[model samples]
Target: MATIRIGLDRLPPAARAAVEAHTGPLLTVEETAEGFNSEIAARVTSATGTWHIKGLRADHPRAWTQRREAAIAPFLTGLGPALRWREEVAGWDLLGFDVLNGRHADYAPGSADLPEVASLLCRLGETPCPSIELRHAEQRLEHYVVRPDLRFFAGPHLLHTDLNNANVLVGDHAAEGDRARLVDWAWATRGAAWLDAGYWVIWLIAAGHTPVSAERWAAEIPSWHTAPAEGITAFAAANANVWSEISTADPDPWTLRLADAASAWYAHRRTG
Candidate 1:
């Protein structure tokens, strides 16, 4: 389904008033073209400072997703943007994130930012996931993989299962610790340390890496090097199935393209 975008003006009067009260008279509201969960996503600047406000109608199917992001924010170290505030503005739920100084990381093969992302993934693997009712990696792909092994995917590590290039931000050149910033924690989960690296493998291929090259990049992470072969295969197969289902449901160009990429990676895992 196409994303439904909501401008600032579309917010309920009371909600708008509530936001302005803290923001001190909004100067500019720029809609950001990213993510599917939120109906309202804008870079807003006030007389005081700038913030990225992401919101969804409280009754929307994905309304609960924002709550997950909000809950997970405090636990993330370098893995995600800081959640500055959260509010229920009228009938809509909203979250304000501290706007960072960076551009979306480029994921094309050999991009300099790849190493930073890999290092950040290691940091995420080290962070203990907060106790929340998170979906297990094994449970997430249950219907797709045959005779799923619960032991393979279950772990205490925090996993940002979606690591698309757009969700990663390359810190400004002048910033200390030019670490890549992960964002969009809506799909955050508790799983094996290597699970998130598997997710990134699919994206690396989609971003133009050959199967060998993608695997090489993923190997940079210590957890990924220690990943069980069976678990890796199961995760790859499951990811392939999920993308295939998504392509079948939508048949959009990008979905189909990524489904093919996942299939290719799965094939490589099996045949090589």
Candidate 2:
């Protein structure tokens, strides 16, 4: 099967109109292939200065995007260079951020950097945000996770859920110890924190790791699982969902163990 590609011209006319309105004449439009959802990266001169435009398709209700951007924008602004402005028009969410010199997916994680990434996950998971209604988690688990029709796991928590290697961007001239920036917040959600950590850990393991690498990841799992029982259970279920889809090997051991653990944890939490 040919892989589906997201391109700039794929934007609906209404969405394009919105982008043109904010970004004057577009000097160039580059389709960014870094996200699960269809996204476009455009370079255009505006009244202020040159800007990077990220346009996202509205998969859910329009209000959801507005609410989500509003909820997380303040938190993400100073943590790293983030979207400076956002507008929803037609069936898309258009955002503008300063044009930073970098490319996504270039950061290669070393054994030493694994802990730092884990620590960053802890920071993101621990940070609190206003509770938003997460009706999608239940629907995702039911339709996608349990059914095994979809390979991706949709877990609970306000997770930057799609934090794979590709989503990370670093300067081309970045030194050895410079911090990397994270983009792509389309999959952000509220649920289990460990799900995000587990997702990365599992990906690292799948990317062909040595015994030492495996041991390091194994040791870090507990820290990711530090959330309360309910949160942990939700994360475990999310992990199982993703594993069922993308794992090359039979997921009997991991899936069964995770499912049992999640069930037991939830039951215990309910009783307590």
- Give the Å shift of residue 65 in candidate 1: 0.7
lDDT of 1 by residue, 219-262 (tens): 98889977888888888888899999999999988888789889
- Model 2 steric clash pairs: 156-191, 156-192, 157-189, 157-190, 157-191, 157-192, 158-189, 158-190
Alpha carbon deviation, residue 10, candidate 2 (Å): 6.3
Error of 2 at 46 (Å): 5.5
- Report lDDT per candidate: 0.85, 0.53
lDDT of 2 by residue, 41-154 (tens): 665564646776665566643335445554565676423455667768777777776766665542133644555455556556556644665444445455333444222333
Model 2: per-residue Cα lDDT at residue 124? 68
Cα deviation at 151, candidate 2, in Å, is: 22
TM-score of 2: 0.62
Cα RMSD (angstroms) for every candidate in the order listed: 1.4, 8.0
Whole-model lDDT, candidate 2? 0.53
